[model samples]
Target: MSLGGKVWITWTRKTKSNYVGKIILAAALTALCILMLKQSPSFNSRSPFSNHEPGVTHVLVTGGAGYIGSHAALRLLKDSHRVTVVDNLSRGNMGAVKVLQELFPEPGRLQFIYADLGNAKAVNKIFAENAFDAVMHFAAVAYVGESTLDPLKYYHNITSNTLVVLEAMAAHGVKTLIYSSTCATYGEPEKMPITEETPQLPINPYGKAKKMAEDIILDFHKNSNMAIMILRLFHPHVSFFHYFSLSVKTQMARLGEAPRPELREHGRISGACFDAARGIIPGLKVRGVDYKTPDGTCIRDYIDVTDLVDAHVKALEKAMPGKVGIYNVGTGRDQSRSLLRHVRRLTGVNIKVDFLPRRPGDYAEVFSDPSKILLELNWTAQYTDLQKSLGIAWRWQKLHRNGYGTSVTIADS
Candidate 1:
């Protein structure tokens, strides 16, 4: 063979060898990515509709028809996020869901699914069907008295169901979670303003169940990339406001707190006071008048529903993978005798009062020191005035004399 021909053959062979090496490297890289994606929890959980508008988040709100959950759903919708609310209507109200549906009539804006979290099959199915970016676990049997009476119900609803939810999230790859815990987990603390560091020696089954749920989430978070936030909320006062946009109090009343009559006994102090003022009941029965407090009544930190929802949204925004955040959400002020005084002055009704023995699991005083939330999430209670907040709620109550019933009458009080 000629010298030049041999050189050309050598160059052609080298070129072919280099091309084959490049193709092999590409194939290996692709296979490695496939394996990583299969093992990655975050990648598996990412929503299929991730190409939606910028800054838009798809959130699944469990128990979104309930008081705090409804308010949180509203806030999320107002901020232009897609929301899916799942509730069995056991303790939640359908009327609240109807109101939200009416407000956000646009499709893909709000969705309500009637499913009990206890049904693990149904919960897993729901997670499989929807591409959820985050989950707000707010569906739980929250009444302390009711929890004591039926501890199984609390365990099944709060603790066991929470395990179901975490399992589904792990299976589906949903990573972000905002848990609605209660300060009841604190029980009767030895200090006045309870901090996040306060020992969780729960006095009631409700609190104990919630603490168990917290433990489950914390355990799951350790070995996962899930961003978990546990907000230990205090007593929520019924009031209305649009944190993102300014709405009139009356307009705000369209979405005010309206617990069902059967559940009202387990509801907030403001709701019971409003009921008495509206003549639904003969009088307001004050439970526990022999506590260590100044007024011999159980004192609790009352957070406005708006502020509580704000903290949840902030926590969602601040959630980081592999990080767990726990905060006591409250106004840091105690409401005891003053809450009743405010209710009377706002309703213009001299509500009859009956002093009864302290309800079981009653605490002398339980308020929160929300400095951690303020510093970390930059959240603070804007509706600090007790009377103003009560007055806004009272107007709504006066309008809906039957608590979300169609029989609306202007109270004569």
Candidate 2:
């Protein structure tokens, strides 16, 4: 063998080894790209439709012009879902709907219909016009005292209207329903931290009507292919725009407080407390200060409106065909007189209080045990700080002092 032949042979072997290394690296890169593409459609917290079937979901939010409903609609819009809001405007504000429209700004992403759920023909017509993937029913007369005074009205609005909605849903074959139930359906629970298993012995007509509606929905679910989620919500505090808008006079009248001429008709305890701190109202009127609690006042689990709506969104995603899911939405913490203290701290004002006797059908304490929802849906309350919640509520109430800018009216459309 010669020196030239040995050198040529060694160079050829080294060149081939380098070529094979480059090919292996190229193949590894290609495999990684393919794997990423395959896993790209997995679940996304920002957008619920990432893992779902293609095309935006159309959700019919009954009472979407109302407080909680409006917030839920806002969340749905944020997650790229098309929302159609149906409201009678009897207890809902059109200004809330207007706000939603302005926020989304995308044409056809949000819509509003002036229709009562009790009117089956109108509800059916709505379903016929649009293909709704789900229905979040929040339309109901929820005033506890008023329901007690006029039990028939509660039955008509809560019970009968629910039946009408269900009938329309069945006709349209809309299988998914997210019902807005209340913790009041459990009445005064014998145990602390009420769970879904608690007996539903509602003490008032309002609670009874909700319970009755729940029964009707469950029956319909059993007989049909409907997926039902009954959320027994606790006290949901104010949202960004302050959704719950009971008349200030009505609330004052219930508490035996003198109505002020300057005050707007719509406000809640959070708003009222904020107003009192700002000297808008005379002072905070504390109703039922003689309840059997540590502070001798009724205790409730106050969850932020945003948190409550988030749970609904999760439930919508998790709803399965021919299944019934019941979850309690609350902070699972008791808040009584400390709520007022928190409000005072948030407002940085010494809020005056006018204590009154306990109202009828008032429970001493009612909170929630939301472990099941936490474990099942991987959902938990984000705005759990009482001061922070009240601060947000106070800011919103201060800006929208008139409550939605105008009273709701029946739309011509």
Candidate 3:
């Protein structure tokens, strides 16, 4: 078989395993993701659509139905703003949206469409329907490891599709945009903390694709007076207990931490699955700035889900002037050396953390210098103090320890 054919076959097999195997993996992933969500403690729904602001009479949110997109959409609705959601429903789930129907504050104010941005006709139709004040483009394939193996998929989705969307937006005279960016764009950093001025050198196709899109948008901004805000997201975890009952907080009091906990004995984590609303334990390796920094370990910026979303909402306000705004979206806080100790204290699982050599394309420490965003957007991370933020994560992990999930079956067409 051809190389493409072989990979296609293997991917097909993995996705279409026996019914029972698919069931087990789906249940496991969902439950694990739910717990991960709680542990990370994310943000959603801050801006109401009817804030009655002079900015953005109508907002076009591509990929508005995904995790961050859904949260942004909910916030827009809360501010009483006119909103439209366009998604292909590939990686995005419609069920994730809240407040689309009830308490909308305005009937027919929020709109949703199942369409791909690559289809310029569909996108152009969307632009024609509304005189949008700004566009928040969040629709793109975002998986680190997967991008390594299949860069074409990432490029097509993020690069080609993004070009199509931007052209349509510009042609329709919609100039404002709030883009979702990542810290990985910094590649392996030379400094402990990365500032907005840090050079971007992405190691993965996903980051490269995002960086490519960033360049294209800026190019458009360079020629045109289209205002742009790029929010470079640092990893933010969301940890929450279901229904607010049997809360993760309660579980923490009941259980204590473990010296080392193994997520699965002799098992490994696949790259595509390394997202916030999923598994948490990655073995601690010591190399990066454990000496220069206070801790003998790497520190990363981890903002709350809510705080991250707040940056996006604020970006809309700054979208009209045609000047490009670049800001690091993170807690301005760093995860600590004592984090592993704290995890064990909370999970009561004896996880074995073997110290390995420094992994390539890995940085020692990189948090955000969020001073500009704080000064510019009048925004700062609301959840300060890393320990306090982590407290909620422990609660989510411990609460969902047993398991709870819905069934899903994956297959290749």
Candidate 4:
């Protein structure tokens, strides 16, 4: 997605040649976008050790096998909290689930259930079997384009199922809920950065469903007295891999005065990875430059997967007696879209650009205003640089190309 642009079409602007009107409209839009940024919610996390509560707490994280789910589960476990995971295994893999299990705090403290959230009986049964102090909901249908085409499925799975889960929560008296909201709800923001107070103008079914779920959850928060933290999750990112890579690349860039870009060996862009004895070779893409950003490429908010989950863990604890806190999760930074160009510039990988039109349902640019969370929760994004983050992602991608982290195997399927 393109990040920045000098020109924009405004609803207030008239097509006719009216220079004064155009200037006024431009100023209005610029002011509105700035307001969105200034009003954005903050996101930061305290160390797990300091954040833990008085007594032992048992937490239930639904959809604990998926990407963000797994990451959150690990964070909860890292803090020595008891955790129970429930996943239907539709889009979740057993391998990812198993890997996450190993990261648990203690033995028998972390458990997994293979069940759907829609089935209140099943959810109730799990709660009855184990005492849970809080519940983190991450299970839902997620896909902007897919949701648009087949809205019913999105509605049924995300909206209907979430309602059922809420009912179950009410029945079981589970008041603490941490919802995994999405940035899609912001939908082609009239402004650059989006805040919690920004009007939810979703243009797709998935965003609508997520927004509906948030509304329902907040309603419950009002009546049921649930302590909820609605986290508006941004792009996907892995912490360990990306942070490490950035350190290496940044060091190299400053060490040598190439004035241009250099090429790095082990850090070469993996155009595609093959799990051979040699190692992983990432597929390199040269396109994505001509965007509106500085390099004419896409810019994204790729929070380290670790930081993403850390925020969730902190968010769950931050909820209070009567109010619910909504926060955005992202680096609040931009990343270049041209993987090859970035690799070449940062790591020095030579690759060709292959231009392609933006995909349907693609957002031009999306980032977070995590200032609120920082002010409220005393949290800040640990991994601040993008190049370091990309290096981490590439490393994780390489190691896991053989289904290292999650179980996603493709053999001409």
RMSD per prediction, one decimal? 12.0, 18.1, 20.1, 28.4
lDDT of 3 by residue, 272-331 (tens): 112112345444333344335565556667666567778998988766675888999887
Kindly list the per-residue Cα lDDT of model 1 for residues 1-413, writing each as its tens digit.
Answer: 99999999999999999999999999999999999999999777644343344666989999998888998999999888999999999878898898888888996788889999999999999988887899999999888878878889999999999999999999999989999999989888787789999999999999999999999999878889899999999988888764423334234337677776677777777888888887877888888889987878887888888898999999999999999999999999876568988988888889999999988877789889999999999999988888877877776765666556653544234
Output the lDDT of residue 34, model 1.
95
Off by over 4 Å in 4: 1-54, 238-298, 338-340, 343-353, 405-413
lDDT agreement of model 3 with the native = 0.66
- Residue-level lDDT of model 4, residues 100-195, one tens digit each, is 555443555678889988787887787666667788888876756567568898888888778887887778776788888888888777677777
Higher-scoring candidate on TM-score, 1 or 3? 1
Ranking by lDDT: 1, 2, 3, 4
Q: What is the TM-score of each candidate against the true structure?
A: 0.84, 0.78, 0.67, 0.70
Best TM-score goes to which candidate?
A: 1
Give the TM-score (vs. native) of candidate 3. Answer: 0.67
Candidate 4 lDDT for residue 383: 72
Candidate 3 residues lying further than 4 Å off, grouped into runs, are 1-56, 98-106, 239-298, 336-343, 346-348, 351-361, 385-413
| Leading candidate by lDDT | 1
What TM-score quantifies how close candidate 1 is to the native fold?
0.84
> CA lDDT, every prediction?
0.85, 0.78, 0.66, 0.64
